[model samples]
Target: MSDDNGLPGAQTRRALLAGAGAVGAAVVLAACGGDEDPAGPGSAAPTAPDGSGEPGAADVVVRAADVPVGGGVILASKGVVVTQPTAGVFKGFSPICTHQRCPVSAVDGGTINCTCHNSRFSIEDGSVRSGPATQPLPAKEIVVDGDRISLA
Candidate 1:
């Protein structure tokens, strides 16, 4: 028998309904089988071998000789700042200021100064040396493997 559209009637309707049901079931099943905890709270966040979140630390390194004596800071990309408070001693911190998370531009004498709000932090220990910033800048671990300086 045919419906008003001049095609199969009940059979076509049944087939169409069955196909839609199957499709719906498949979609539901697929949704249930999603990625299992790609990054859980307990799981260790993926990081470079040096323990830094930045990748390719093994290849990227700064030499102590390049850094100026007394104290000098280099602002690396990705909010990284490498500082040498004294010759042969290097420290790393996030270039972002603790006051308002502004990028620290220069290291004068032994102070890492933030142009934003003039917040100043000691290059020696990343401690807050001036007002507008109560908390110290977050320090990044530094690994001195031979002459190469890698972030940890």
Candidate 2:
């Protein structure tokens, strides 16, 4: 009773529809991801190179006094973690973990920790301090203007 195509008309039609649905879903996923977090669902609003929210915008991340020497602060809105590795040096990196694109949970004990998979990255250079991630965190430049901090 089957046609020369080796399947009934309804079965062949159903198979084609299933394949099309899968392709459509993949396209939808690809369109949503552009840059910043390539494979992530998305990230916070774009953080400008100067860390300003927008043009003519000068965003002050935090007071210099707020960041502890040898420690850092997580500016969620800016999607950056600023670390003061030494007495007066500040470093910035994307908080998204390279392990699985999870937002880094915290910087503690001199490492950035991701709660999702227990991956760790050094606070000093964003190098992987633990496994499940081989690539270091992506660095972002910032400038310390006296007591103010902004993307550079």
Candidate 3:
């Protein structure tokens, strides 16, 4: 038995409707695709914008005083970790763990720890102190001018 389009029976009509619905769902998903969210600013870090409005130049991730000697702070919003391995020396590195890209949650006992996979990194230079991450966290360039720590 033929319907208006000559496709077989009620079963065929049901299949056609289901297929169309699936296609519509796929289109919706494609429209929303991207590495960043479209709803708002992708990062909360404050940045100094050029007149053209493209930001991230000379952004201050944290105050020099905020990072403690022999410890670090995870700035998840900026994907950087600021550490003060000594009284006056400051360092920065990518906070995302080398193993699975999970952000390191804490700087404790002279190591940065990724809660996701138990990867440990040295606070002094972002080197891996233990596995399951064999690679070290990559360095992030920053300039320390007096009391401020800004991305370079």
Poorest stretch of ten by lDDT in candidate 1: 52-61
Q: What is the TM-score of each candidate against the true structure?
A: 0.58, 0.61, 0.62
Scored against the true structure, residue 33 in model 3 reaches a CA lDDT of: 92
Give RMSD to native, each candidate: 11.0, 10.4, 8.4
lDDT of 3 by residue, 50-147 (tens): 32233434466787889989998899888789999999898889989999988889999989999999999998888999999999999999888776
Better of 1 and 2 by TM-score: 2
For residues 18-91, could you state the per-residue lDDT of candidate 1 as single tens digits?
Answer: 99999999999977985666676588656755565654554445766666765665555745677787767888
Q: Indicate the TM-score of model 1.
A: 0.58
- The candidate, 2 or 3, that scores higher on lDDT is 3
> After aligning candidate 1 to the native by TM-score, how far in Å is the CA of 22 from where it should be?
43
Q: Relative to the true structure, how large is the alpha-carbon lDDT of every model?
A: 0.76, 0.82, 0.84
Clashes of 3: 0
Best by TM-score: 3
